[model samples]
Target: MSARRSARRDLRRLSGVALTSLWLTSLGLPAVFSAPVSAGAAGSWVGDAPSVRLYTPGREVVSQPFLPPGTPMSAEITSVSWRFTPPPGSARLETRLCHPQRCLWLATPRGQSRALAGLAATGPFVMRFRLPESARPSAPLRIEGLQLIVNYH
Candidate 1:
């Protein structure tokens, strides 16, 4: 009888974990359940926060990887998704796409106050933060974890 009860308890625990993973996947956030939660060090970017505070009117290069001269990529960004914390306190998130020439630079706005209303643009955005102040300054807003969801052909 004792052995049977122990087995039953173990089964329930496993079941719960499975259910949780499934639920997260359904929400399009499988990173929480996967072992490799992040691409940066230690599976997350919580240790570092944005240092730039003044939102400026210049273009700040975020991530632009150079291929092996002749490398090819047919990736068309369908959408993007990001998760952050130490979060905006009371401020919201906005998406800014720096469309320069033929390059699209994705940028997240950083702010120090709750009134970051002028720091972002209101539109159909995901995983992108847009700050209104368009001047080049130091880092301000800090993001914990950001994930960009893309569909490749």
Candidate 2:
């Protein structure tokens, strides 16, 4: 009798789980029952130059590579994003992100903030800035409140 009760209980539990998964699927959500959750180390840091008042065309200003936000010495980076004041007029500002191994350039600005993709690394990473010679700013171009955020798991 005890063994029969245990088997019935197990069937009920399995049926409940299957029903829950089907309900979640109907709602277009993942069935996360007993799934392992991944932990992430993600944070933002101030650039070595918080702001640049001097606008030197065609010169690359490099910031010292900053340490990872927490304990992510060898974690794979998943994303990069930035916030900064855009250069005035037609001046196109560019930013470069580098790990010891390689670099990636963020896209030209359509606004003050952007989330960029295609960066993968385990980092202590460096940042570089440039205003190209082709840019024709009617006013002085100043970069302010430059910040970088790194995300990894």
Best by lDDT: 2
Which stretches in model 2 have alpha-carbon errors above 4 Å?
A: 1-49, 109-122, 136-140
lDDT of each model, Cα atoms only? 0.36, 0.61
Which candidate's TM-score is highest? Answer: 2
Candidate 2 Cα deviation (angstroms), residue 88:
3.5
- Supply the global lDDT for candidate 2: 0.61
Q: In candidate 2, what are the lDDT values of residues 36-79, reduced to their tens digit?
A: 44555454433333565435678787665666545445455556
Tens-digit lDDT string for candidate 1 (1-153): 699999999999989988988888899986354464232221111112232232333323242221112112322232323334424452443443322222233333432211212121211123334444443325565544433222212
Model 2, residue pairs in steric clash: none
Candidate 2 clash figure, as a count: 0
lDDT, candidate 1, at 79: 30
**TM-score for each prediction?**
0.27, 0.52
Which regions of candidate 1 are displaced past 4 Å?
A: 1-72, 75-79, 86-88, 97-140
